[model samples]
Target: MNKEYINIALADDDEDDRFFFTEAFEDLKIKNRVSTFKDGIELMEFLEKASLLPDLLFLDLNMPKKSGIECLKEIKASSKFKEMIIAIYSTSSSEEDVENTFVLGANIYIKKPNDFEKLKKVLSEVVTTNWQYETSGLNKENFLLRL
Candidate 1:
């Protein structure tokens, strides 16, 4: 399948998890860029200064600097990034966490897979579906104008 390269940001504290996700992307052979942040505060800071905002964000529920729920609330509250696709990519399977994330305006909630095969499937679905917003021949300038 022909796929456009998309920029993605990931917010998670665990080093091993980060490495695993990076590996999963590599294994999938998806054309994309992935940026990583250890916490919500750092991710927010990057967003504020970043010239190129990510097409998708994968956020974890637990972190040291700021919680994912708090970050989600802030992102949803902001008009600047309101249209950006934010997904809750966490280990939590709690109903409350899922409900709250959606209420806070997350586009999707995905549990972190335990194995490489599951992670590969998750990555494939994410690239093929959730991140595939139709541009419909609109360039960045035109898209921004329409927005």
Candidate 2:
């Protein structure tokens, strides 16, 4: 078995969602180094630390301490971490929330699936697609150049 690890960071307040996400990732047979943050504050703290940046981020909009929107703003504002792929993975299907997330520079906004089977499928697709894309290191200057 090729144990190639993919680093993924998740910022969500719901423990059940985190558990399900981890299970789904495992079921996909994806070698992943998954890190979970209870809320945006913890996520921001990890991101601020140079050693903790992951290859991808899954953010939930409604979180305590600091919302995902706030975290997105902070991450995008920083030249050091702006290029990291930040995806808004939330239960919210509100068009306003989706539009705001994209307008604030989120790479994508994904609706959270209710069923475990559906969630697994969604996660598998996301993981596969993310690896297929070539993502450079997080740097605002280079990100803007590419865009």
Candidate 3:
């Protein structure tokens, strides 16, 4: 981890979403290093070998190969990734998805905002959130971070 900035990682297949995600962090001016991956497979591969894991991870549920749900299961199953804070960043707000990811140990869930400004606001809020409190004891109510 960089001593000067928070290390944030995002895994999303959509090119446009990836662009907007990085842009939101840049505009927040919070001194964060944001790295993005195109798919869960790629993200998992990096995590397996990375010396310093990101302080937080934003994962999208749907993807062409190795869906986020699969990735979450894989991540949660391994002891090495136990402390990683994972947020379910996806367009889907399905109840099943929410409940499933919550059970799988996602730190939070966020529905993608259609407006860029809303997205920025949510991202900023998440970046500033005290994750230790939220992750210490998972609460169903706080599991989904509403914007």
- By summed lDDT, the worst window of 10 consecutive residues in model 1 runs over 138-147
lDDT of each model, Cα atoms only?
0.78, 0.78, 0.91
- Per-residue lDDT of model 1, residues 35-105, tens digit only: 99999999999998888788789899999989999899888888888657877888866778876776676
Instruction: Please give the clash total of every predicted structure, in order.
Output: 0, 0, 0
How does candidate 2 fare on TM-score? 0.83
Tens digits of lDDT, candidate 2, 83-141: 57777889876868877876788776678887898888877766776432534333333
Q: Which digits, one per residue and each the tens of the lDDT, describe model 3 over residues 1-147? A: 326899999999999999999999989979999999999999999999999898889999999789999999999999998878898999989999999999888889999999999999999888788777766777899888886
Model 3, residue 52: distance off in Å is: 0.9
Query: The CA-based lDDT of model 1 is what?
Result: 0.78
The prediction achieving the highest lDDT against the true structure is 3
Clashing pairs in 2: none
Model 3: lowest-lDDT 10 consecutive positions: 129-138
Query: What 10-residue stretch in candidate 2 is worst by lDDT?
Result: 138-147
